[model samples]
Target: MRCLLVLPLLLAAALAAVPPLLGPTLPPGTELRLLSADLRTLHGAWRVEGRRLLPLSPPLAPKAGQEVQLLLVLPGEKPRAFPGMAERGDVFLPWEKEQVSLLRLLKEVYGLAPPERLWP
Candidate 1:
């Protein structure tokens, strides 16, 4: 019957209208590393040191004096670095429009649960 066919089509249309459900949530303490820069020319390994963020290692730590730059390879364009001071137990980067969104993305990718508060 035309009504029966229309019913299935309507069901299909309804399903399509719904957005795909997100997968299981990530656990806490998970870390994400955004590429600090293009390392195609440089030679060495770098370690991640923050949540949903990456920081340059001290030149003397392992690969001392190696030239490196942070290049964010996101959709819009190069990644911009948020500048801030490190005090107590947090790295304070300058607040920007994308800062919160970036942090949330990093948390999702890294499987980090929402924190009680931003680091001070």
Candidate 2:
């Protein structure tokens, strides 16, 4: 019946309307790993600017990976033993190659502005 078919469609729409769970913003120095990722090319390397990591040069695409690591220089800050999730706006510095790249979470209404970068 048309009503039955529409019911499924309505359910699907409702499910689709649900927004994704954007995980909490990970603090600076949170070490992340590159389990899997996509390659991106940028003009320059990443550096810490205030509380955010902005590129010295214009960003080509974004050297974003599925996971990454963060390094902190403060006292009593050490890497974790177990693995966990990395959400958007998480900024990480790549000390070695074959690792994930930095992240600048942009979660605004327009999503055009970059989120605050977390650095130690």
**Shift of residue 58 alpha carbon in model 2, Å:** 2.8
Which residue segments of model 1 deviate by more than 4 Å?
1-76, 96-120
lDDT of each: 0.33, 0.34
Best by lDDT: 2
Q: Candidate 1 lDDT, tens digit per residue, 1-120? A: 899889999877854443321223222322222222343432211233333233333221213222233233333334433333322322223334322233333343344433322222
Worst 10 residues of 2 by lDDT: 34-43
How many angstroms is residue 41 displaced in model 2 relative to the true structure, after the best TM-score fit? Answer: 3.3
lDDT for position 42 in model 1: 23
| Cα lDDT, model 2, residue 52 | 46
Give the range of the ten consecutive residues with the poorest summed lDDT in model 1: 58-67
- What are the RMSDs of all candidates, in order? 14.0, 11.5
Model 1: which residue pairs collide? 36-70, 37-71, 83-94, 84-92
